[model samples]
Structure formats: C-alpha cells, structure tokens
Target: MSSQPEQTMETQQQKKKKWEMPDTYVILFSVLLLAVIATYIVPSGSFDREMMDGVERVIPGTYSGVEGNATGFMDIFLALQEGMVQSAGLIFLVLFAGGAFEIVERSGAIKGGILRAVSKTRGKEFWLIATVSVLFALGGAVGAVANSVIPFVAIGVIIARALKLDAIVAVAITFGATFAGFNVGFLNPYTVGIAQSIADIPLFSGMLLRVIAFVVIVSVTILYTWIYAKRVLRDPSKSLVGVLDESQASKEDLRAPFTARHKFILSFVGLSLLFFIFATIQFKWTINHMAAFFIIIGLVSGVIAGMNYNKVAITFLEGCQKLVYGALIIGVARAILIVMENAKILDTAVNALSVPLEGLSPVFAALGMFVANGLLNFLVPSGSGQAMIAMPILTPLADMVGITRQVAVQAYQFGDGFTNSIFPTSGPLMASLAVAGVPWIKWAKWMLPLLLIWVVIAVIMLTIGVLINWGPV
Candidate 1:
C-alpha cells in the first residue's frame, strides 16, 4: 500500500505541467527590439557640455534636436558588437571571477566552510540567515558592486538546503541582501562615490543618513527572508522553487575536520580580500584591476588546495565556461544603451524627463528625481555610468527646484540601485539568477513586493533629506 501511494504521488508530479520560462536572451532581445522601435519615434537631440567637478556636465538649459541616426534592423547586430567592446571590462571580470571562484570550489574549501557553517547554525538557522544577509549587505555598502557577491550564491544554496529551506531563501540571503546594501550603499564608491563627486560633496560625506538607509534596507531583507524561510520550512509546497534537492553539505565527508589545505585556502581568501580593499582605496582600482587580482589569488588558492597546475588550469577554464552564458548577457544588455547612444535619443530622453521637475517643490522634486532615475536605469544599468549621465543633469535641476544636491544623489542612488534587482535589462541580476537556478519570473514574483517596500522607504528617506535640507560636509 505504501509503495502504491508513493507511485501515485510520483505519477501526479510527473503529470503536472511544469512552468517553462523564456530564456534570458529572448527577454533581452525582445526589449532591444522595442528600443530600436523607439529610436524611430523619439526625436534625436544633443547638449553642449562643460567640465564641472573634473567631469563633463550638461548645461541644464542647452538641449536641442539634431538629425537622428535612425537605428535600423542591421544596426541591432552592430549594437551587439559595439556593446561587447564597450563593456569588455565588465564582461572579462565576470569570466575571470568565475574561473577564480571555480578554483575555490574545486579546492573543497567552500564546501568544507559551508559544512562548518551549517553545523554551527543547526539550531539557530534563523539567526544564520540574518548574519549572512548582513555580511553580504555590508559588502554592497562598502564599495562592492551588487553583483560582485554573486559567486557566493552557490554556497548559500548548500547552506539553505542543509537547513531545510528553499532556493528562494538561498538567493534572498546572498544576492538579495547584497542588492539591498547595494541600493542603500552608504560608502559605495560606484554609486555614492561618483554621485557625491559630481554633486561637489566631500567624499563619504552625508554618511550618517546613508547608514540609517542601510539599516532600514538590510533589516527589512533579514526579516522578510527569515519569515519566508520559516513559512517554506513549515510547508514545503509553498516554496518558489518547489521540491528541494539534498545538498552536498549534508554528506558525511563534509562533517570531517578541515584539512590544512582547506584552512590555507580560507586564510588566503581573507588576505586577498584585505589587499583588494586596500588596493581599491589607495590605487582607485577599477573592476578590471579586481579581475586581475582574482586571477592571481585563484591560482595561489588552487595550489594551496592541493591542485596541480594542469588541474588548476582545467578547473579555471571549466568555471569560466560555466559563466559564459551569463557573462555574454552582460554585453547583450549593454547593446540597448549603445543603440540609444547611436540614435542620439539618449539625450532627448534625459532632457524630456527633467522638464517636469523644473518648478516643483523639493519634496515632489526629490520624489520625481527618484522615479526618473529608476526609469532611466533600464536603459543604462551601470551604476557609475548612470551616475555619470544622470547626476550631471539632476544636479543643476536640483538647484533650480530648490532641492539639495545631496538629496539628488540619494535619489539617484535609490533609483539606480533598486531597479537592478528586478530589471530584465540588468545582466548581473539575470546571471546570478541563472547561477542560482531560480527563474527570473519566479525571482520577480518573490522580489517585487520587496522592491515596492524599498520604494516606500525611498520616499520616506528622500522626504527627510529634503526637509532637513541635507547638505554636504
């Protein structure tokens, strides 16, 4: 009788129609097609620029239409190559970083570490969720790109399963938390650092308010993720990624004492991170710089983990190969912006968007600023890139609307950071989701409500900044 019922349940599961999600490329290309259509309808325009704060700034009132280089069908293919070239640095970082992490994985250090983490958190898994989320969140706040912490999502999955939670909880604690901190980045060099520089504020100035934003954002992530994890633990059917698989962290071998090789791998990773941080601040290291750093560290880690040169090379290539699909999307996503830039409508959109806030009060102006940047982030997903374009326009506009430049930067930060988590155009989000094996539609279903909550928090935070007349240090 038991076998018969089990067979029936298995039959039922097999008969159930599974959801087939569209590929990330299909979604991105579909959007790219829409962007091509947009070029025909939207008038092309340009602005005269003058250098301000050591970077080019668009003079607020100098917008004019020009003959558009209308984007055609052939242009779409051209945009792809151009986008790849334009985003080569970021794409290479993803490839190299993937290889670097693959080396870590092959060493069994991460697996060993996860085993220890799972063992330690056996009875206190809820706090484990909070602890891990906060750590990834801080990474975003402290100059890490939201996607930079994505390599850890695999670890998160292993830990979540050992605790009997689902993949949503796995990603929520890692990618989700990192993005939350990315959104509320108090000291984020890419978002906060760039915007502050353009806004003429001292570096790391206005940090106290950002600290509060960080707490609000990260706390909400912890609470929401824990609640969801508990709900799934109680009722497995409610999981977004239904039917959990047993994790490797549960195997008997994982419970053994860490080998000296694994221990050295861990120590080396910590030391590498410390040096990376120092190098970033002291040398103004870019993502490419960090990518090279990872390559070196990965090799050292591989040797320490007992892998010979050939094995390390093979493992590194395998890692990079795994990430190729995700990494390629980075370039594809960049094509949308390249298309707009070529058509010359990029400036037109910026100009048109700013027109509404010309005479609004600071409260509404600040609110509008946030919304505008959120909309614009779809077209230009890069943090520093968005800062480069939007900050220049919004800065002078903030002055005209009687809003503070610091508040403007806050709006830009929230707008650019929050949307990347949900936007289809965000390559890193999609790549991370692919790596997690959680589909975008499912991820969206889980993440959309949190994004709405973020918008509410953004409103409250921006309102406070406006009322306090938040100023530079």
Candidate 2:
C-alpha cells in the first residue's frame, strides 16, 4: 500500500515536458527557412527592377536581383555567408570574454575571492545581494561582458544555501540584480553610445541624467529581487515560483585556507576600477563597452593571483572552448538575420508593421518605436548591431511623425537591454542557461512575471524620455 502511493504520486507529479526537443527544432528550422525565402527567394518586383535598371528600388518587387543565372539555393547560401561575415567581430568579442573568465576561474582567483567575500557577508543576504546587483548593473558599460557576473550568482546561491535559504531564491536574486544593472546601463558603451551617436548626441554628453535614471531602475529591481528572495527563503516550495530550479547548481569546488589570494584579487579589481575612473575622468577615454574591460580585469586578476603562464593560457583557451557551442548557436541565429538583410526583409517587416500606425499622432510614434525595437531584438540579437540597423530607419520615421530622434534612441536602448537577459537566441543568455542547467522554458516561466514588471517600467521610462524630449537634435 505504501509503495503504490509513492509510485502514483511520482507519476502524477511529472508534468509532461512542455517544450519538446523535436518541436523546438522544427519551429526553429521553419523560422530559418522562412527568413531565407523572404530574403533571397521571394519574387519581389522592386528587387528585380532595381537591380536591372537601378531606379532607387525601395522595395523588391521580385528577388531575382543578382542575375538571371543565380539560383535560389545559391542566393540563400550567399545570404547566410554574408551574415556570418558581418557577425564575426561580435562573435569574437563574446569568445574573448568567455576565455578571460575561464582564466580567472581556473587560476583559483574567483573562487578565493568568493570564499573570502561570502564568509565576510555571513548572514547578511539582503546586503550581499544588493551590492552584487550594483556591481553587475555596471556591466552594461561593458556590453555583454557583464556575463562574467555568473560567478557572483554562483557565490550568492552558495551563500544562501549555507544560510539555510532556498538555493533557487538566491540564484534568482543574484541573476536578476545583475540584469537589472544591465538593463538600465546608464553608461553602456554599446547601447547608450550607439543610440546617442545615431541621434547626433556627443558621446556620454548627458551621462548625468542617464546615471540618475539607471540608479533608479537598478535600485527598484534590486529591492524587488531582495523581497522575492526573502519570500522564497520563508517557503522553499515557493522558491521555484519565480525561479528555475531549487538546486540547479551542483556543489562548487572551494579552495581552502584562503589568505593572500583574496587580497590579490581585490587589489587587481580595485586597481582596474581606479584605472577606468581615471581614464573616464581625466583623459576622457571612454570604453566602447564595459564588457570588454571587465574581461581584461579578469585576465589580469588571474595573472596577479599567481596563475602560471601555462595555466593562464590553458584556462583562457578553455573559456574559448566553452564559447564555441554558444557561438555555433549564434551562427545559426545569424542565418536568420542574413536572409532578412539580403532580402530586405526588415524593410518589408517594418513597412507592414508601420502601416497601421502611420496616421496615428506623435504620441503613437513613441509607442511604435517601443514595439519596433522589441520586434527587432528578436531579429538582431546584438545591442550595437540592432542600434546600427534600426536607428537609421527609426530616426527618419520618428521625424516624419513629429517625434524627436532622441526619443527614438531611448526607445531602442530600453528594448535592447530589457530583452538581453531573457531572449533565447541571445548567445550570453544561452551560455548562462547552459551553466545554470535551467532549461530555457523554465527560465522563461520564472521570468514572465518579472518581464511584465520590466515592460511596464520600460514603457514609463520611454514615455518620460519622450516627454523630456531626450537626446540630441
């Protein structure tokens, strides 16, 4: 009787896995196939007429643009190649950061620092989570390099567990806090710089205002994360309510007898911050993205922590290896962008999307920007890339509807940052998911409520940006 109840309970508890592998694969493949057709094979008259007679073809009426002899298969293949080429720099950047983190971790620098830091924090989970969130929020300045915050997350989870708190709650707070900073990214070089530049704003020219806005967003996000973390700690079963797994992280390897190693790591990080602050203040040398800078810090930290040359080299190499899978996924995802660009699918998508809102008032233009940026995020995963592509289009469109270019840029930045932590196709996002071993569906489920919160916040922020007429003329 006892055994029967146990078996029945087990069977009942196992909900059918919602997102099946085959279904996901099929859906992805179908989307890729459609993107290809839309770009290369779609018989558009504009493409045909423009290529043959060059009459400033705004839209392709026929996609037979290359020549009469070019096959549809060859066209799609070329589009894919073009995408890979364009995304090369971005892919390299991601791999570099991953390698650098590997060096820091393998060198025992990260672990040593974590042990010392966690022990010091002790039972102050609230303070610890808040501080970590602030650190990660600065990640936007570095671009996606903020992903290095994963170690902080692991440490936070471990600390929470030691305090008898639910592990998932800790992970959620840590991850959410990091992303909160990432989302606001007051000084994000890739996002803020690109958007401002597109609207002709001097680089970091209005940083004070952005910093204030960023602080507000990050503060609120951290507070909410802390609140949620406490609730889960109070009820372990509820931990997974807005979280992925209660025990996704296996026990981490902690080095014992932490001594001077902690001091070394802190010194390295402290010096790095000093260098950046000095550069930004005195020399006016602005890093294009903060992500790259942090990776460099990690590398330098490893070397200073006594990791041998060979070990450092191998550790960096291992990080590079770790990025390969994510990179491949990126490559596949870029194929979609490639086809879209070659076929001018974005132009078509934008045209169709903008049609309904064309006659709407100036206020609606801001709304349009928000919707467009969010949709474009799905197609172009990189913040800088999307800004480069979308800003050029949105700037002109916004002007036509009495909206300022600055408001458009703000709209783009808000959409780009908000989605980075959740988008399945985002390379770093997948990397985080892989390390955490939380399925994408599970992460999405946990984030849906949070996403709603962010969306509402973003709408309000963008409205403020528009009301204040944010950005350069």
Candidate 3:
C-alpha cells in the first residue's frame, strides 16, 4: 500500500534535482583560478634575493615576488603549468577511492554485511555507537581506511534508520570519530611522515608518546559521542537533528541481500588487512606503498567477490573519472600556493604575525599556534603543506616561548583536525555532504553545537597535554 507513495516520492526527487557544485569545490576552484591569474599577472623581483629564494623553491622564478605586480601575476600561469602533473595525481587518488567504494557498495557486500551486523546489534545502541566511534577514530589515524570508511557510512546510515535514530548522527559518529583519530594520530602519515622527513625525526621514533596521546584523544571522543547521543536522543530539542527528505525514497530501498559472492570479497578484505599490517610493521614499508598495496588488494577483492569482469573494469575507470572535480579543486588550490609563494607573502605573513607574540608565555603561545594553524587551513587545505609552512616558523617561535616543538605540533594538529569537518573548504566534507544530499547550512546548524563541544573538549585535552608534558616531540 505504501509502495506507490514511495515510488512517487523517488520519482519526484529524481525529477527536481538541482545542479549546484559543492561549496568547497566552488571555493577551492575559485581561489585556484583567481590565484593562477594573479600569479601570472603579478611582477617578480619585488623583493631581495634571499627573501625571494625561499619563495622560489615553493613556486618558480616566473612567479617569484621579485617581479613587479603585473609581471609576477603573469609568471603564476607558468607555475600552474608546472603543477599540473602533481595536481592530477592527488585528484586520481581521491576519485579512485570514491569509485572503488561505489563498486563495493553496489556489489551487495557492504549492505548485506551491515544488515546482518545491525540485526545482531539490536538493543546495544550505546556500545554500538562507542565501538563504531572507536573504529572510526582508528581508521582516521590509519588513513588508508578512507575507502573502507565510505561504505561504512552507508552501513551506519542504514543502521541508524532501522534503529529509528538520526542518520546524520550516525554519519557524524562514524566520520567524526575516524577523522578525530586520523587527525590526532600520534604519527599520522601526513603529519608524522612529512614532519619526520622535513624535521628529520627517526621513522616511528616517537611511538610511546604518540600512543599515549592517541589513547587519550580516542577515549574522549568515544565517551563524549556516546554520552552526547544519549542526551540528544532523550531530548529532541537539545539534539542536532538533520531533516530527512521524504522525497529521497531511494534511501529506503532495501539493499541487495548477501550472496555467496560477497563472502569471497569479505575474505579478501581480511587477507588484505593481514598483508597490510605485516608490510607496515615487519617490512617497515612507507604508508604510501602500503596504500598502493591496499588499492591492489581492493582490485583483487572486487574481482574475487564476483564482480563481472566488465563491471570491474568499468568501476575502475568510473572511479578514476569521478575524481576530475576533485583534481580541478587541487589544481585550483595550487594557484593559491603559487600566489603566496611567488608574492613571498606566506613568510612575510608568518613573520609579521609571530614577531609580536615573542613575549607571550609558552602555553598561550601554543594556543596562538593552534589558532594560526586553524586560520591558515582555510587557505591551505593540505595538512602536510600547512604543517611544513607553519611548523618551521612555529617551532622556532615555540622555542622562544620556552615550549617544546612537540607541544607546538600538537597545537597545530588540534587546529588542523578539528576544523576539517566544519570548514567549508574541506574536500572530504564537501564530498560527503554532496553524497548525503543535505544542504551545508543545515548540516552546519546541526553540527555547530558539536563543533563547539569538540573545540571545548579538544582545548581541555590540549591544556592537559601541555601542562603534564604529554605526547611525542
């Protein structure tokens, strides 16, 4: 009896679709294009040699600040040409991951597994949320789990609906937890790897300290999410509720049932993880190689999991194709890099901002570092790049304020990780939002309270870490 209404709703939704680009992509591309134009148009040799040298490595001579405004801007176009290959690589990764996830979901493995799993978890909401949250955090820290996590979102959403809970809450729980862990990982490949490379720290050298910090942060995130979910569920007004569009009837379509084929895929995933763990720990392989290894594993899993050979080929291609927008975003973001590097503005900006803070206490200065890093994240979306640009200056400043460089790094991380979900400039956030078919403003309103909660909790944790001298250097 209800089927007709559901069909009608689904049809209406499909017909009334809007074609808006995501805000993050829009902003990223807008900035990138504007920056490219400015880079090519601006003049170089606007500054002295030593000052310009630092900028040049980050960019090129054509875009160096030495050129007069007009010429320097024109030079930026050349830098963009130089950046094409790198930008394409980043885009390919994002797209490939997305497409792979799509194949996994469409294959009935994720859906069937989620349904079977949720049926067993019937009355254990608190524990379920906590466990899932913990897993999410772990995935974030591990990072290579992004491809895995996307499918889990669908699982989380489905489970939430079956349980009569808010789907957004589930989405938040899964993603928020994972990102919290990833961003704050004791040795996140992005931060720790890059930091170690640039700062010359021993590989996996600071394990004990990073482990302690990860435990502390992970515990807090899990606990808080469970408690917060309970409070919100009990009192609707207090909760951040996402509006469900009744017209999106496709969300309610019962997923494909698990067949023997899904079992093969699941087995492959298990074997893949075992290989990844051994490779990472035993072989001491870099995470990059490990990530690439996982991609191959996914390919094998997709095929063995009973994907029609043609479908598998198409999925890989489609996955690569979906990444074009993301690639464009990265390419555009490069424009910002070119402009800042060429104009020699980043260094000047950092120096100008930090010189006045020389007299502050280490704690306050640490806090300032956090704020500065967070602000710059809006402009520089890449965590590795931001850490590189900010840390060099921030570390020296921390030394001046009598704080350890490690503490300075924590502040940078806190700011970097927390804002990614809230920031309109974040690619993942935009991608997730687009997939969910929710408006950003609405999601923001629902998430604003949580964001505030996260900030307060993170700041409190940061204070403890700094005062107690916890965490790796």
Candidate 4:
C-alpha cells in the first residue's frame, strides 16, 4: 500500500508537468527571438506604396532588394519599445475595456441576471445556446464583435455552468460563434470592408454569397457546440476542463436575485452595444471611440448600481489589474512584426511566397492566395493592416491569373478572420481565453477538430467563388 501511494504520487506529478501551460510571455519572446534570427537569413526587400482612393496600398511589381537592417541583440530591446509605441492605442483600449467591464461586474447586476436567466431557461438550454450564439454570430458578421465579446465571456461561463456544461462550451459559444461570423463577414467593416476597399471592389458587393456562408457556418457552429455541450452536461467528468468547471461553478452564487437594478444594468449594456454597432458602421468609430464609450458606460453603470464614486473607481482599477497580463500581450506580440519590419524582410517573404502562384489555374491561385494570407496572418494579425499589404499585391495577381479581385478579397477575408481564434498574437482572443480561464494549449486541442471542419468549409467556399468568377474585376 505504501509503494502504491508513492507510484500514484509520481504519476500525478508527471501528469501535472505534461499539462502545464507555458508562459505566454516566454512563448512570444521565443517567437520574437526567432524573428530576429530570420532577418539574417531572409533577403531584405520592399515594395513601393502609394495612396489609392484614400487608402495606402502596395504597388505591385515595385518589389526590389533593399539594404538589410538586421536586428542585433541590443536592438531587440529597441524593437520592443517600438512595438509598444506602435501598439499603444490598442493596448490602452484593452485596458479601458477591462476597467469598464470590471466596474459593471462588481455591481452584481450581470451575475444576478445570469442566475435568474439560468433558472428561467432550465429546460430549453439548447435553445438558449443557439439563440445567444446566433446573435453573437450576427454581430460578428456585421460589426466584427471580436473584442466586444470579451465582456460576455463571464456571462457565458455562468450560463454554461447553469446548463451543466463546461467553460470550454462557454468559450465556444462566445468566441467560436463570433469567429465563425467574422470568417463569413457579410458586412464586417473591419475585415471585409477594408479588404474590399483595398481591392477596389464596391464595399459589400459580394454580400449575397457572404450571407449564405454566414448562415451555413453559424448553423454548423451552433450544432457543433450543442453536441459538445450535451456530452459535458450528461457527464461532467467528460469535459476537457472538468477541473476548472467544477472549481468555478462551485464558487458561483446562484441565489442572487434578478432585481430591477439588474434589468436596468443589462439594458444599459445592450443599448451601448447597439450604439457601438451603429457608430462603427455609420460614423466610422475606431477602437479609441469604443474605449471611450466603455468608460462612460462603466461610470454610469456604477452610479445606476448605487455605487459611490470611490467604490466605482477602485473596482474599475481592480478589473484593469486583472487584465494587465492580457493587455500587455498586445505590445509583446507586436514585437514580432516590428523585428521583421525593421529588418526589411517582410516584403521578401511575401514576394517569395507569391512567386509560385504565377502559373496555377484560377482555382489553384485563389487557394494559394488563401494559404499565403493565412501564413501572413501569423505575423501580421491585424486584418486591415494585412489587407493594405496583401490586397494590392493579390489584386494584380488575381487579374493576371484570371481570378476576380472580389475572389482575392474573399481569400483574404477567409484567411484573416478565421485564424484569429487560433493565433496567439490575437490580443482579443487571448484576452477572452484568459477571461474564460482556458489555457491556450487546451483550447487549441479542443478546437482542432472544429478548425479542420472550418478549413474545409473555407476551401469549398473559395472554390465556388473561383468557379462562379466572383467579381468586380
């Protein structure tokens, strides 16, 4: 019996080591170091850029060798500073959003409301999942609700637990639904609008097909999540994150009543979200505007919750503190691109990759563009930024190969949006995962099967686009 105990202890230790999540900073820095090294091996090159219809676009055939500015060990530190400077706007937005949400969370309105909702939706849990996921998906399709969905992660967790599901299901319902809609991008201003503008196609001209894609993808996602939710609900032990679910679920205070205060707070949140969508679509609001709105919402929500000024301030700061790790990750991840840009090798990589598509058929060329954009997304995760760099090059290439510029935009859209969920560099996704308490490795493991299905769907859509000559060429 003594020997058996020792063996059990040793086995547990090995399992713990096997499942431990690697520090995100360490992983990002490792990628940064690898980028620094890549500068030496990859030939330095650049393309001439020019303003086209108020947007900067790369001029194809302007690619040429440039003098290398390889980053040394000391220069890496400078690159970090540069990266931080470049990403300051985004970093602050994330912080402010965190701060604002924290204040709202402290009010107990959200938690209380979720508990009440759980009680009400007891028998029709699948409908609850389907409804919420479809709504999120629609938001994503129209407005690109990636970061905006972060606040919902906590509520999703509550709902998932109330339904006897795991945290993974919560994340899937929130992030997964949003990303599926993002990939479809029927009218998303962030990816589709920007890519279409860059490609010089009428903005949202290909809406019919994208809308079709949206319905199919969102339906599939809801079905997939529902199946997993059913399994986990039936047997909690079957959850990949069973331990986290149990711990988190045990701590929830299900007795909190859904009072009139909760209703008002939730209404405020809902109205603010509606305003955000309108501002983004009509008035061209950026992340800065969104952050400011959140700040106002936070302060107002605090007052509505009967909190005094000092309490609100302290609670907001505490929320920001919780997200410090997630916010800093934006700057750190930016360092990889900074290092590559400072080295002048980003264009070289693009050029070399684009060279192989010259002789392929239109279908293959579109597929190649899809693959290339996906690879590039690993380095430059920003959708609009990638569009500015890629669409210009891809537009001319598409013209040369008989694929439509619209098809090229579709490829860029598919590549840029879908991978955000999987990419570590996506600050919003990482932040959501952090909020959900799901480790990146475990999330990836759970997501792989769905990801494969998504990829296949993307390929089929792109091929159809090619066959139909999706165009405004």
Worst 10 contiguous positions by lDDT, candidate 2: 46-55
The TM-scores of all predictions, comma-separated, are 0.68, 0.67, 0.66, 0.67
Over 1-473, each residue of candidate 3 has an lDDT whose tens digit, in order, gives 99999999999999997976445545555665664555444443322222332221121122223433332545656656654554444444455554555566567775575555455566888766766676567656744344245556665665555545665666666666777776666545555544433432333445565566677766766676676567756764564554343354354454557777887776666566556545655676553563465468557767776778788878766765754554455555555555566554544444455556766755677778888788877866666555545665565455445565566677777777777777877767666666555567866776677667667756665566568765332
Each prediction's whole-model lDDT (CA): 0.78, 0.60, 0.59, 0.75
Error of 4 at 307 (Å): 2.2
Query: How are the candidates ranked when ordered by lDDT, highest leading?
Result: 1, 4, 2, 3
Model 1 steric clash pairs: none
Better of 1 and 2 by TM-score: 1
| lDDT score for candidate 2 against the true structure | 0.60
Name model 4 segments beyond 4 Å from true. Answer: 1-22, 132-215, 227-254, 360-449, 460-473
Residue pairs with backbone atoms closer than 3 Å in model 4 (clashes): none
lDDT accuracy of residue 355 in candidate 4? 72
Per-residue alpha-carbon lDDT of model 1 for 307-365, expressed as tens digits? 88999999988878976775677677778777877898877876776677776777998
Give candidate 4's TM-score. 0.67
> Number of the top candidate by TM-score?
1
Clashes (N, CA, C under 3 Å) per candidate? 0, 16, 28, 0
Better model by lDDT: candidate 1 vs candidate 4: 1
Q: Tens digit of lDDT per residue, candidate 2, span 246-333?
A: 3644555233345676567656665675566556556654334434675687568667768777777777778878766544444455
